[model samples]
Target: MAHRFYVVSFGSLGTPDVVWAPVTDTAFQLDFEESLWCPKALINDVLTANRLRLRVASRHGWAWADGYGRAGVSTVRDRTPEETDLPARLIEGGARDGA
Candidate 1:
């Protein structure tokens, strides 16, 4: 059986929380309360494509969702960006001011 996937992002004032589950599952019988199901191949692709980006974001205290075959709650630190190699233009104006 093919596994479905979900990408849940915790809510914030600016961005609402979201659960990216399979829409085609009309029965909604998937057990996702404790864990999401992301396929192994896709997870590998994502990790390979975003390895550098993920590493840099980690340095800025950003958090990520659990990967394929993993189960856990996501977390992030609330703090101002002290420094970053990422361009300032990429960040929003408010974030630039330590918002």
Candidate 2:
């Protein structure tokens, strides 16, 4: 069976900010201290929506490690509830009304 995995980069708030790459090799060794594993499916939704290019960059970011022997999926939050509420706040403040 072919297994798939994702390497993700997270922001300071522990939200996944970027997807580094995907590997099918379950035995692939990662720089364990610096990175973590996530399931390919979990990241696929975001990857498809944003059309993000998957590639590893710098060394500091959060990662999701599913408990399964194979990589697992986790809930990915692109922004905090407060962050997502900004537009609503702006609209309520009349910013959208050209105030």
Candidate 3:
């Protein structure tokens, strides 16, 4: 049987918290709960206290779903010219560089 893949981003992209697990809900929930280390605490509590954020995505159809897979692919496009130039424009507008 084909399996679906789930990408869980706990903090930010490329961070160690970003993980891909198989079998949909079960795997993700198990891993997430383990990380929290608080079986009694609600998931919402962990999110609020740690500022934890999650982004989940899946590929259409199915390929394989087994244990945690690290070979998953995620691509990020480069910033547009306008986006890249925002910092310069802000600096010109009297905004401090690091502020």
Candidate 4:
């Protein structure tokens, strides 16, 4: 079996570039606090963990603990609708049409 680096992230490194070596490629994206967790030393062969749902405070809309989760698979914790900003197609336009 083989693995590929589709979306590289470096949370433990605190820098996304640290994961991408050779210092190549100009086109890229960078996010400081708003970025997602980057894998450090752990490597899942088939990928076991995935964000299933999000938790939010009942009093406010602050981001709750983004604890480990699985989409429609595991029930590690209760999920609130506000906790996930899971990207969805607002308008299902063709990719060629800049969707």
Best by TM-score: 2
Candidate 4 pairs with clashing backbones: 11-38
Runs of candidate 4 with Cα error greater than 4 angstroms are 1-42, 50-54, 67-99
lDDT of 4 by residue, 22-89 (tens): 21112112211212332221244343322322322222112212222211111113322222231111
- Backbone clash numbers for all candidates listed: 0, 0, 0, 1
Query: Model 1: how far is 2 from its true place, Å?
Result: 40
TM-score for each predicted model, relative to the true structure: 0.18, 0.24, 0.23, 0.18
**Residue 68 displacement (Å), model 1:** 8.4
Give lDDT for model 2.
Answer: 0.28
Clashing pairs in model 2, backbone N/Cα/C closer than 3 A: none
Tens-place lDDT per residue, model 3, 1-99, is: 333334343332334454443334465455544433332345445432212222222222211111122122221232221223222232233222122
User: Residue-wise lDDT of candidate 2 within 1-99, one digit each (tens)?
Assistant: 222334333332233443335543342344332123334544564321111112221122222332222211111243222223322222233111111
- True lDDT of residue 27, candidate 3: 59
- RMSD in angstroms, all models? 14.2, 16.2, 13.7, 17.5
Task: Find the candidate with the highest lDDT and give its number.
Answer: 3
Pairs of residues clashing in candidate 3: none
Residue 58, model 4: lDDT of 24
Model 3 has how many clashing residue pairs?
0
Against the reference, the lDDT scores of all candidates come to: 0.26, 0.28, 0.30, 0.22
